[model samples]
Target chain A: MKACKLFRAGDRPVLVDEDAALTPLCSGDEREDRQFGKGLHKEIAALQEMLYAEHQRKVLLVLQGVDCAGKDGTVHQLFRKINPMGLRPVRFDVPTVAETARDFLWRVHLQVPRKGEIAVFNRSHYEDVLHPIVYDRIDGPEAGCRYAQIRDFERTLAESGTTIVKVFLHISKDEQRRRLQDRIDDPEKHWKFDPEDLKHREKWSEYHAAYEKAIAETDAAHAPWYIVPADSKPHRDIAVAALLAETMRGMSLAFPAGDPKLAKLRVK
Target chain B: MKACKLFRAGDRPVLVDEDAALTPLCSGDEREDRQFGKGLHKEIAALQEMLYAEHQRKVLLVLQGVDCAGKDGTVHQLFRKINPMGLRPVRFDVPTVAETARDFLWRVHLQVPRKGEIAVFNRSHYEDVLHPIVYDRIDGPEAGCRYAQIRDFERTLAESGTTIVKVFLHISKDEQRRRLQDRIDDPEKHWKFDPEDLKHREKWSEYHAAYEKAIAETDAAHAPWYIVPADSKPHRDIAVAALLAETMRGMSLAFPAGDPKLAKLRVK
Candidate 1:
């Protein structure tokens, strides 16, 4: 199977074959996969220590996608290996009265990871652009301003040393239908479904358009958006793990040599 | 030097001599502490997997405290070790119209950790008893209702397998005054001080009374409050880590073990 090319759009939505056989990424390469996973886990663990010790770098992971796109599952599975001490996940919903009065980003900014900490936004600041554009909550001209505001906000965050990785979990509508149906058919899974999900499903095309535009406008060198295929859970997990591992590896962190004076002390 | 004793009402707060000679907890004696911190980290990691694999469990960590009491430092230091995936830290603030209109715990309940994930609230539901009671935001018989509501809410969480660990980072007023001065005098630490903190400092007695009442009323076996001495950062970190570790060790977990068919293929 051919490797899936990373999607980069100019004016249109980039189409991907949802059912295309996933090129065996880190899978067949078990040693590499295990090494990568273990190493990434260790590095994250250490990064967590650095975050605590120095409190210097703030990290944010933003996941945006359509229903059944595997945002929740991907986060649970891939991050399962991380220590809880350093992990924080924030899910954004409709703003409350106080939040609405502040700049759309205020509530979000307050939640940004402090230096050395990792904060995940299950759906994040992008919602300002995506929701407004899709729901006609803002006009095209207004949406343009919102998009720029988002870029500037993210730019400020990046400048402050926040490594932002935005993942757009791309899944075909057919797959969404199948997963939604699976939730509906299984009694135990019924809790996962919401009727409102269908309403959002009905406006699939609009959301897709909104997402494409949002990605195009905000994709930056500092905070790039990766459109990852989500048809296969294991494949998506492996791909995300690989992407995260690569990102951390690029950071080139060194574990602090223990304080020589403190290290020598025998506490008995 | 003796181990720090509990503070009684109408008495001076207990103070531990920072440089006093003392026996260190042995590696074997500290196994519970080591296991607690390591185990909690592992539990959180497992939960992250459960979040991904099964998408069950929303976890919430609520930290409530007085000024200079080390909420920021504890969260900064302790959670620094967890995996960043599927973890979120939410810092609760003064109630807005939407929050005020809802029951006291409404916003707190909304932020509960989802299955297989964890959410940390810098200050949480107990604030219903703490802030309101302290500031006269809620009073008289109504405050009684609020306390009962918090207990019920936490009980419901416990029944549903939501583990709640409430930590009160206890510090004496004298220590708070000293820390506040340190923040003011040290150029590098000046950013941490807010003039508004002085205003809260003035109301210290009222806040303490509120806290004592809240702790006495709401400390349940399911979600008991752990009061860690905040004057010593290392001691606090070690104690909190040990407590969290013990909590996770008690919650026995088993890895997915992979599919039996997949396991067979792996052997070849």
Candidate 2:
């Protein structure tokens, strides 16, 4: 709950320090922070129920990170208490042939949360800007155009009853190396280890620059981007949980009122 | 597991007698059945991991039943042991405007299991046939055409290394009435109950007939339809789990052989 620079909320998106691997929110006691996060998950679940009951607005949590930045793991832990019906976690991998034919946002727009729902994009439209820019698939001008499009798309969503929270899971190059190494060392997790990830690992600095540019260009008052330090898995989980809890509470969601006549009527 | 009629693997899909409410799989011992189901879940999970490790095939479990037939509950109980990374549970509610824009199978196709994945469709494209026919929204000839289309769609999927297992969760009218009443009685569960279900309840017999005609018309060696008595929720869960286990075992899924080079590779 302390002031954490990682919890950035402003119109001008700030660049995260490359070495910003420190967990500012850590209570310095692992068990204490774990317990606190456990309680926060329950609170978020309760708040989600109220949001669903309110049945008017929606929440969209966009999670972006480099490979092994714990976006998937954070989702698995942060959403344990939430109802799967209300919480839609969509992991967008490489776009299909059909998806490629359309604008990048076309597929993403299809998955946005409807009324009284929470949708978490595991890796989102941000990938379009980051990957194309990093791989030289698109030049600087095209990437800028996409950043503007994303800003407008998110601004429209925010204007039309959606609370948007974007998080950049900032993990160090060394940490990512260790995580990828862990996957390679465990044969059970071999399905998750992609050879393409090593190709991306070779361009970590370029990716870091891509992410920084994407965040700075698209960040807005309506769509605030938080850079969460994710070097420590436990810290990453709790920090993201806190960020979600804080975002939901800021919406001031409450359960809808019932019809007074319904109180008098009993079901047959 | 003693010769449950639910596991119909024959090329000709048989009609589920409208009055068939018997839970043949139940060993007449609820506790024992629960314990047995508990064990089967772990086996299914292990097989799923191997399926992922093999990364050469996919499994698609299509669950179809009338309102309050426990499709959602069965999915929750059945795949609990399986890693969610591999288990994709898609509940096909009434299609939206965008979905209706394309052929019925277009949206369904988008959600099919990829290689090394297990996708469960709560209520699949079969709804396209059943609902229209039951309400006379489509005539007999048109219904037949749609059935043929589904058969082709599924055959294509099965030919491409996808294991397709379709299970009809058969619950009695009395059982559905009780379940609906339970939802009505519990305020907390009222969200799960829909008013439209009562209208559908009146046409239950017609829907069953529609299902029989569609299944018989579409059943092929590549795609077999099973009718699982679902009056007992626990029994329904276990039976579906068993059906999935049987299907995967038949596929002879095994982990890919360990690379000789990986045995010597070390991670720092």
Candidate 3:
């Protein structure tokens, strides 16, 4: 039933609730979390193979979240088993002089998947709405225009056979504080922590409101968004992977048929 | 002694003979290959960390070879230990409508590594010269201009702190025939055996001369070419891994220093 609900979002917009969005999937059930994670990985791997062999459709996965939302870990663990050849993950950061000179979507457009490819955007063009609007980088009319542009750009890509799946890894303020502190204490992970993260955290409510508005406005039939709980790493992996696998399993894919004469030869 | 000579490409543009070029270090011996691979992996990992932490220099690795010359195998083995976060491998194929419209370097410039990253071009801008020259796709002034553009483009990248390492995997005609036939005989590998490869094989002498000329013309102090003997997979892997590790070892890098007061804070 949960899996079915996940698939129902297909090519349809769904607004996520800000208050209840951080609901942990396995708050009271460790057993269920572990089982789901293991099963989802196998299913995702199979789905990935089908996508690769078909080589007709493209999948774009967008991961957006606050600091310590486990975006990187979720990607590394869930897609670890898939053949690296078919997977391309692009992480968006502060735009360079070259990127800023162009439209906000210019850098994002270059990373879009070609046919038979799966591309994951660690952070995406949505940042134009989420970050700039919240940080007051642009005023009302400008922000509104950029939002419409992103939605239209995504629509064009979908018409061209790109399947856009957006996921928001939602984490609570308390959890963010806990995770940031852990990074400070852990020597190996110290490199990941930055004081600037705290500056962003100070404007937590602003980011949350921006994200909520973006999800509600832009989540459309061509590109839908999924709000995944990010409190537990294993649960987050299972939920995200399960959603992707369920989405891909519904697609039509056929392997390329090799030459009949050549097919019979078995390498010894 | 071996480490110093490993990075030195001599005054020549390309090392035409494997035995003579690699005289500084013993190769082809199985024991030496194993030792070379292991040591090189460790050193390269360190270099990768420095490059990433310092976030200043960008490195590009270009691999070109005949089919079955072990390009795929070498990339897998050499980068097996490198941090995926710091490594970006771009494999170019037939041009798309978007790519074909621009200058030959347009698609490639998009994939260049950011500061403190390593980008590997499986078959790179060199394809403009290698493929076109081999197939008579272009000739006369057009071919000459393409070749000159490639050299100038690479020189500019190098001057901008992008370390360029070009490797041409060299396998004898007999060895290539043996490997291609092996792929044909194996069902799992049959997909890799392209009939078009045989077309290129028929013009081996022409390809060889074209490659020789391209290497000579393009190789410079900033971007040197390594003519790796790929008759043996293990030997090829060792040489490549060693060359990469030796290059990284030469770059001096220091870890990012964090504030001591902040580092001492414990938040529970």
Top TM-score prediction, candidate number: 2
| Over 4 Å off, model 1 | A1-13, A17-39, A51-54, A257-268, B1-268
Clash counts for the predictions, in order: 31, 0, 3
Best by DockQ: 2
> What order do you get sorting by DockQ, best first?
2, 3, 1
What would the per-residue lDDT of candidate 2 be over residues B154-180, giving only the tens digit for each residue?
999999999988988888887888888
Indicate the docking level reached by candidate 1. Answer: incorrect
Q: What is the TM-score of chain A, computed separately for every candidate?
A: 0.86, 0.95, 0.88
lDDT of 1 by residue, A1-268 (tens): 2222343233355645453235355466767666655665565556555554445776788888887788777766565545554566677767889999999989998788766667778888888877777787899899889888998999999999888778887788777888887766554454456666887888888888888788888888788777777776666766666666566556765443433333222211
lDDT of each: 0.66, 0.80, 0.75
Off by over 4 Å in 3: A1-50, A78-85, A96-103, A136-149, A183-193, A220-222, A252-254, A261-268, B1-49, B76-85, B96-103, B136-149, B178-193, B231-239, B260-268
**Residue B192 lDDT, candidate 3, scale 0-100:** 63
Predict model 1's lDDT versus the native.
0.66
Give me the runs in candidate 2 sitting further than 4 Å from their true place: A2-6, A9-56, A81-87, A96-98, A135-142, A187-190, A249-268, B2-6, B9-46, B49-55, B81-87, B95-103, B187-191, B255-268
Candidate 3 residue-wise lDDT, A66-181, digit = tens: 88888777776766555445677678988999999999899999889977788888888988788888889899888778878988999999999988788888777777888999
In order, what is each prediction's RMSD in angstroms? 10.1, 4.1, 5.3
Better of 1 and 2 by lDDT: 2
Write candidate 2's Cα lDDT for A89-165 as tens digits.
Answer: 77798999999999999999999988888889999999998988889999978988999899889988999999998
